[model samples]
Target: MIVAFDFILLLFVIICAIAAISVKDLLSAVYILGAYSFFMCLLWAEMGAVDVAFTEASVSAGIGTVLLIAAVSKTKRRSKD
Candidate 1:
């Protein structure tokens, strides 16, 4: 069961990463990147790295997301040049 859960989480992380890269909308891509970080944190917890997971969740999913969003906000929603 634990292995199965890890597999699922891994799959979810991969999908989110792909979506983050392929999405045309900058905001949606950033949100997906944040989701990828959140899943990575969950995967870390499942692997018994609680402290690392905590840091990943707080830094990646929290601060990283905020910074990405702020950067995106400074640019146009769609690119023309």
Candidate 2:
């Protein structure tokens, strides 16, 4: 059961990573990267590294997301293609 849960989380992380890179919109990519960071935190917690997970959650998913969102918000939206 735990293995199955881990697999599902891993799948989500992979999807988020791909989506973050593939998305053209800066805001959307930042949001997806935040999701990816959250999934990584979960994966670390599930693997029994609570300390690492806490750091990932607090630093990456929390503050990092906010910073990225702010950066994206300050930029003018434009399509390259």
Least accurate 10 contiguous residues by lDDT in model 1: 72-81
Q: What stretches of model 1 exceed 4 Å from their correct place?
A: 79-81
Give the per-residue lDDT of model 1 (tens digit) for 1-81: 299999999999999999888888888988999999999999999999999999999998999999988988997776432
**Colliding residue pairs in candidate 2:** none
Q: Give the per-residue lDDT of model 2 (tens digit) for 1-81.
A: 289989999999999999988888888888899889989999999999999999999999999999988887888644453
What residue pairs are clashing in model 1?
none
- lDDT value for candidate 1? 0.90
RMSD of each: 1.9, 1.8
- Positional deviation of residue 19's Cα in model 1 after best superposition, in angstroms: 0.5
Q: What is the lDDT of residue 45 in candidate 1?
A: 93
